[model samples]
Target chain A: MGTVAIYSLFIINKSGGLIYYKDYGSAGRMDTNDSLRLASLWHSMHAISQQLSPTTGCTGIDLLQAHNFDLHCFQSLTGTKFFVVCETGAQNMEILLKTIYELYTEFVLKNPFYEMEMPIRCELFDLNLAQVIQKDRVALLGR
Target chain B: MIGVGKAKQYANVLDKPLGRGRQEVSLSAFAFLFSEVVQYNQTQVDNIAELERRLEDAGYAVGARVLELLCHREKGNRRETRLLGILSFIHSTVWKVLFGKVADSLEKGTEHEDEYMISEKELLVNRFISVPKDMGAFNCGAFVAGIVRGVLDNAGFPAVVTAHFVPIEGQQRPRTTILIKFAEEVIHREARLG
Candidate 1:
């Protein structure tokens, strides 16, 4: 079994705009402007990785590993990319990302007042995301 | 660049967690919210068309979003490119996802070649909605029709979707028939491409 502890979550829209950004723990600190810049930078990097592939078309990157943290990316059919930053060697990352995508669809997209491609500020979405993060508290604290 | 510790204050805001739950919301909450949406629009619109349009507009965003999510959830994330394929996807998969079941029936228009119909015996959105006679020819099913239109339009099939109340024999409530009239260009393209 693999241990997983998520640190932060980022959602980039199809046009490389940062739509939603949330931090789960005190893992890292970056200002709003810096985060936005990093989001777009990562978005372009993802696009470049897909293009640089030897194959004619690439499905983009799904996961990235680093010394202290790991990044798992899930791209929806509509081109929205959800990035989850978890501890190294996180297990069941796929399931967690899938649940997060589902939550975004349900709480954010399904919200009547939410405008498309806007910075997600839905109260329900935040609530559900917090719940998901809380459920993994033990794993997160173990890190 | 400043010390990383200074930036820590920004992350401290979310230190405490909030409410809980996944996708499912309370039915009573949705009922109240939907009722308010209808009531708020009813006060603003002067005619049935405008009211229905408002409701449809509300559902349109939902449909557009659902189409993408549903496509993502499907195996291999394959999208429906054909007319019949998308219609079936919306009728079966989309309906099941949104309403918890497939629609009652999907019928091709006998009179018009460019039309299709999805009939529902009783729509969930309209379950609690009781239309007053004074309002005249108002059907909440227009919201669902709007959603269908949203899904279709987002999938590159531009069409006009309208809801009609067809009374079934011995049924207390009228069945909703969502009539979809495809654009002439869509029909032409389908014929040429198919």
Candidate 2:
């Protein structure tokens, strides 16, 4: 019925360039240049976080947030980022982000068609995600 | 590993709760680990069939251990002698021990006496799996095949388990049928024994 208020999603490469982007909700609300620049900046911050990582062989950044929107970034242990963007006030975004990461790890990364650093194109991931987001949206809208 | 003495002591301390004797674990952990296994195999093999083989091997290993434990629980009772008997034992005891449920259906091959089929509406590993278009060559069913191989091997019946996504005349979720063909020697021995 309804959907989760996930504004957009992005995937940043290890080097911090924009690799993938998708807007699930109504678009044109945020400036395109601003989002891209933010992605770039977060990429840098993620790199810094990686440097500060106590564990050796640790990969990309995770769950970086700004004032207007929250950014959740999951880097594979190999340094690929799976990013999710949601409204700043969204509830339990972290759990949803973790669930998405789990799905990616299970469906996308495990998929032989999914090459490293390539964009995800697993049908199951998309379908299950849509269902989860839709449920969240309905709950949010109802509230 | 916990020492036998410690294990027994702990078991004694928690007598009432431990009386049930079985432990429940989070299925999520198993799913995550299984996902990694699929990914690791995907990296090594080029084609779907090979990947399934790898999964089957993995399951075979687990099955061997499961069979030993099940028998041990039975105080090291001898394995089943007949094909139907062994299969029935696997469907009920082995399946319940591993997957927590028996397979959906167990049918004899109409054409071949030595061949049998186990159909599962929802396989444990494939329950949450959605194959990406790029990896169209691979099937999640291989892991299930591996599980079957494991169960059979432990029961002293060596067989080849192949996973297939066969669409029946009317089915919603893809039906995964594991085709089990016992080794020629096994059937030959059965005939000789008779």
Candidate 3:
């Protein structure tokens, strides 16, 4: 998928629960159980990485590079994590994740019916996420 | 600017100047915060009326603080004593500082002596929300209505404030009208002052 780069996006809440997951036409899509397990695994790995650091104030893993793809992780102040798996050495992943965080805050957190620290069900959030990821991440910065 | 690349210290938070009673918040940021306010209130109530009342109560807190803040900073410590004077203050000064623009229209009711209306084409809080078909006759503007009520009550002009959607024939989105019906004492005092 040359035109569409990102494989999938997963959002983990403060307590390491999978709150949101979206796959943008990946070759192999994981089941919901697999997705939840992946989220919990990432959360623990992030914590363990911080402890493994020699010096103090070490934040968890920011990027994990595999032969096939790259995984980028962004942690908010409140411990919520947003990770995007994309094509190898994908550009502007940081910017993309940050914008997604903003979208999460606006559409999901702001929605009156939405329960906090739960699975995201807002239509606006889904629509906005699709638009941002499908297009070039750099282009969305003007907003 | 004095201490670059250093943490600034304050003796007391209250000792700082009020800073011209104007602040800027990005529209997106404001929308998110407003949504949180709505959502928090939603979890606490069951019925629509209760939800609206809770939202209004939240707005009232904001309005009361805003009145106190503006009265000190903008009006040189002189609070508005007249009904028209206070309405103008809210319509212009308070609206400008909080919402970045004045309300669209402020008019006295045609039939009622004590009633007044402040209309906004698209209230900032209502911008992103599209009320569901099932949740009929519910408007997020109730929070703003509470704000108006808060301001009026704090100013010693106790009134009943409510928000309604007034449909305009050609417009796609109906306008929000904040209706204020003054207490009997306010009307009597106004007549005495006149």
Give the best candidate by TM-score.
2
Write one digit per residue (lDDT tens) for candidate 2, span B50-154.
Answer: 787788888778877776667656435577778888888777877777788988899988999889998888777776677765555456778767877887876
TM-score of chain A of 2: 0.68
State the iRMSD of every prediction, in order shown.
10.7, 3.4, 3.0
Ranking by TM-score: 2, 3, 1
- Total clashes in model 3, counting residue pairs 3 or more apart in sequence or in different chains: 0
Q: True interface contacts reproduced by each model, as a fraction?
A: 0.00, 0.39, 0.27
Index of the highest-DockQ prediction: 2
lDDT, candidate 2, at A116: 63
* Residue-by-residue lDDT tens digits, candidate 2, A4-80: 46888776666666655667874565566766787788878777876999999766455656777777766655666
State the weakest 10-residue window (summed lDDT) of model 2 chain B: B14-23
Model 3 accuracy (lDDT, Cα): 0.87
Two-chain DockQ for each candidate model: 0.01, 0.25, 0.19
RMSD each, Å: 23.2, 7.4, 7.5
Write candidate 1's Cα lDDT for B57-90 as tens digits: 9999999988877776663467888899999998
Ranking by DockQ: 2, 3, 1
- Lowest summed lDDT across 10 adjacent residues in model 3 chain A is found at A134-143
lDDT of each: 0.82, 0.73, 0.87
Clashing pairs in 1: none
